[model samples]
Target: MAAAAATNVGNTWINIGIFAAFVAVTLIIVFSVSRQNKTAADFYAGGRNFTGAQNGTAIAGDYLSAASFLGIAGAIAVNGYDGFLYSIGFLVAWLVALLLVAELLRNTGKFTMADVLSFRLKQRPIRMAAALSTLAVVFFYLLAQMAGAGGLVALLLGITDKAGQGLVIAVVGGLMILYVLVGGMKGTTWVQIIKAALLILGAGVMTFWVLANFGFNLSAVMQEAVNMAGENGEAILEPGLQYGASAVSQLDFLSLALALVLGTAGLPHVLMRFYTVPSAKEARRSVVVAIWLIGIFYLFTLVLGYGAAALVGPETILAAPGGQNSAAPLLAFELGGEILLGIIAAVAFATILAVVAGLTITAATSFAHDIYASIIKKGQVAPDGEVRVARWTVVVIGIIAIIGGIFANGQNIAFLVALAFCVAAAANLPTIIYSLFWKRFNTSGALWSIYGGLISTIVLIIFSPVVSGKPADPVTGLSKSMVTDPSIDFHWFPLDNPGIVTIPLAFLLGIVGTFLSKERSHPEKYAEMEVRSLTGAGAEKAVAH
Candidate 1:
């Protein structure tokens, strides 16, 4: 109750110490690796020297954000069957990335996702569109990670006031900027690798401990959760508890599923990781290795979620400082008290830091390489100038993230991440798919798809129930909508997620834009891109005009 009451001052300090130690150690690793960043290629893609397994672990680290650890566990603790769907959606997304996007993107792009898109299209406009979309997606993602950090630290340190939580978010953002500015891609990769290992290992330990309490009987664990839930116990095990109440809710779930499954292939950060590995083969292997590790970790979340339900209870979790995000930490406190909570808190912090660093670097690279270098400078900038611009962009992005995270502090991080997935699926996925597989996808079509999807998804989000007009939960007395002011209702969109409408609309816009354009089809360029994408020919060099 009361989010575990900070237990004792000694325990709180211990948690802070553990978290501080992790940041210090990682900072050292970042500085040591910073020396290797001697060129644009080195800073952007880690000199393209990472092996398959190494990149795979880092990819897993990058992919598994605060949403995966803090948010999903909390979601399952509260929503039961509906909550586990996030895990399934996130894990299944990898298949789409692997089968359709990973190897081809790796073989064709040099540093950023825009590289792949601009290969056979008009370089300046296509890169600018791609860069804008990448920045928007990264901004949404960074907000989720930052919000998670705020809630998590507030729960741990018992900082309930909004100002205190806002300060915590700022601190996390500052550290993220530091990591990107000092370490670049190589440093960030190492941090991810380290964080990913710790996260999985911590989750595995907690899962085993939770099951051990039930004599390793998963069914028994579920029964205990059911009994603890009282009147709502049976509903927890059923499908309709969260999403089955109305047709609109069911439609929302479908939209959510589409976003989760299709969004990974278009996520700028995840796509950027492919360029860090050496070749198309390793990029393929990276996805395979990531799948195995990620699958195992999600399995752990199932036990952890139910374990929290049985041990900590949903009321206690929701009452915590972080709301639903407090489930896993509260469970840790319930199981092993001070020590385990400290350890888990540190790992969760690491999760946020690694992910935000990855996102910040991606946004920075896109701005410097695609927008600044390709568009503003007409590709005339020196390597040092580009890297300098990237560092400055990191600072700007980090500051913006801190402010957004402050406003988003108490929201469920997983739900926030789903919104990001919706944006990615709508804004980037259509263009990416058409550019890779459709020979007639010209510059006009790419621009239409990117701008249309990006603008529509964002506009819909602003006018949806997610932004305003949703009533407070009858039981909790809290509104799920971002704008909690009941008098300021302006939402016109009925669904919380606009993916169902926006994703299809984006794809349709791509086709229509292509046909409407009188630009001649570049059959020769398309042929070269096809061969290069499939065979890894000329991949060592970035596509040049």
Candidate 2:
């Protein structure tokens, strides 16, 4: 597949410069945006001020990341029909967000999920639970991004030495923390806006070139994958034999697909991003933009997926610049050589930076807005102070995320992604949906939903086979600390993703708990939910442009 040894010096310098620019540009945006805030609304929600297009780009910035770029492509390289399943799951999950939660969320919550739940419930446990759940979701999502960014940045910079990647990620962690500190929501939104445009544009260019080379032929690539044996893994396109995965055995390809698609709407980090925008209508339009952008990006990914399998072979994924996750990055290099390769790497790193910033701020805001302002203060805090406290919380949360990434560096960390989706489904979505749509939903029901889902999902994953198998240790090459002698024979969980079990349990718990409680349906509240969510009643009249 290759004749020239890759010095990668050109790619490295270009990446460093781009990474530096993203940090500077992101901070400047955040700073300029931050200066506009006189109230907490401006700080946290941009004073309900984002335009439809700006919100749309922000949605793209929040949703896509290394997991989408690197993880999905690698899965395609390794797992056949099941790989495409992720795209279906991710794209469809947005429908659940768009059709069901969007307007209700806008109408019900002001700054946080707790705002919606507490709209009806007494405040004590509601704010605390919502904040905690949001934090947990943010922590895991942030860890995955930082871990990915540092790893890729190191490889792009030609510092593949283990210590080198760690240093690179630490720098990424610093940049993200500053992004939140200086820019707050305003700055973060702009960073997301620019990054989203670049990411989609870059992917579009690569896909165009690739398609031109292949006569726009999708079928040719799939056939090539079937025949090609990938790099280090010698991974053939055959379904049954991926690094010793079963004939989709206990874990059927269908369930794998289900976890990914169903998992999207449930992600707390993704959903919380909607709160930053002003209204339900804006949220709807934003989803349309995200779907359009994400859909196009994914279409391009299919090209990279097949291109890698066709040109590089699946085994070559292991040796590509960024490890197995390098499939997409390597595909860029394969298609356009060094200059295009540098641009792709920069865009890929921006994808990581922007996504993590969203995760960090979402977590910190939930903690401050929901937990501190709502629960602790009982709606009594000054808006300016609330914004200040949130800024500080961002610093604290950033430290926690950075620490987690360092501890977990050099590991596959792919499983962390699935775990995040599972948690989002279990903890955040159920409580959110019931509070908005179900009239019978009460405070007790909301609490139980959040906690019950959170506890069960986390407990299940810790003891699951991926963790239990004591799978390969990323650092020591020793067995995983969770278990010894990993095996498929004594499988505990039915499948890897807990969505099949946990998502349903989350819904059941919320509904059953609501029905059991005295139905405290405020007539006005129910009317309001219906108006805000289903129709555009109470909508602000648009100013003539």
Candidate 3:
């Protein structure tokens, strides 16, 4: 027992040491890049200097959140094959971004998603609508990242106190703000690149360890997972394990798949990364590279998930502080002991930091460039002034994230991330597609799509089982309601994800509003927009630092 106690003590120190080293390296990158962010262009778009590979790596880092790394593994550990569905959906979503949106966005957009929307539409109203949708997506995404950060820190660091959790949230919030304020887009990009490399390396190591333990035989690992699953062993390799086998469950799964597939094309942070590349061609190339890297990473999650179930056991994982979020770390511990666990934990922390920083920058850019500069200043704000407002907006957004993280503690990180994707798909994707494709799509249609998608997603999620209803405990079959102390469950929305309904509704509203409006159609401007979007004519040039 004494020997076990000593081992625990040593493990804790190793974890702390690795985490501290990661933090220190991230800060160094931030400070080193701080000097180059003198212009609004540099602060917002990395001066368009990054190679496709670099930007692709950063995109991977930004997209692969803590939920992807830890939460997905945990979900698989608990739910088996159903958890792998997320991986397929998420990877397929990049094809949408690649074929439909990537090049057009890079060619026409300046800094934020609003820039792309406002190119041919009435500038002020379109920017306002785009900004609203951008903020809506960013808000929910930020909440998920912040919440995941707090939960992971509390769990991995062995902090049991509420105050300790709050501190962790604040520290993470502060660092995210610092990354944006000091390093700007360039700094954030480099940080993401580094973090992505570390994350892939760590996950690769874990995957290898999992395979080695099963004699490098995939079938052996599967059999082990089956054995560990007991009576439900066969079900572990089937689809109905997580979402159930009902009509509603099928619809829910479809909705979730829709969100994961369409959402990536619309997310503000992910779209904003296209602006960092030099040309539409580079933007296209970046998505290809990102697809490869992200695809490989999700494949690793599959192995890690099954490995955790077979090796770490679900009871041990569920009993951990962060539940499913602890599955990967716990698996690391079992396979490679404390040092590997610590490395994986630190990489996960870095992943969260990079993602939140990207989100903050996108949100801040929307506020400063779209609302503040385009609307309030009527596009007359000096570049310096715009950049200054962006920095301040980062601080404000950071504070909100910290508070939201505190309240969002103990919520399912993966569920929150899915909600964010649902909103993005419903609100942003339709508008983006119509703007780039349909010549008759007017300001009214843009507004309708953005507002319709945003409002519907929020309302549906609020009434969904994920938010208001009590979910049945997997082991005990007991309902644990999150709504009220008296357990008032009012979840009329059968689907946890709103994308299946909301996405089509958003597209329909855009089309309806466009034809109904008496506003003059902008075929001439659309002609120009099409040329620029297709040929990269008059695209924003990279500013020299």
Off by over 4 Å in 3: 1-10, 471-481, 484-486
State the C-alpha lDDT per candidate.
0.88, 0.72, 0.87
Residue pairs that clash (backbone atoms under 3 angstroms), model 3:
none
> Could you give candidate 3's per-residue lDDT for residues 407-478 as a string of tens digits?
887666666788889888988999999999998899999999899999999998888877776666677654
Best candidate, lDDT: 1
> Which is better, 2 or 3, measured by lDDT?
3
lDDT of 3 at 29: 77
Question: Which digits, one per residue and each the tens of the lDDT, describe model 1 over residues 241-297?
Answer: 789989999999999989998898899999999988888999999999999999999
Which candidate order results from sorting by lDDT in descending order? 1, 3, 2
Assess candidate 3 and give its TM-score to the true structure.
Answer: 0.96
My TM-score estimates for the predictions, one after another, are 0.96, 0.90, 0.96
Model 2 misplaced regions, further than 4 Å: 1-10, 230-256, 470-491, 518-521, 532-545
Per-candidate clashes, comma-separated: 0, 12, 0
RMSD of 2: 3.6
Q: After superposition, how far is residue 234 of candidate 3 from its true place, in Å?
A: 1.5
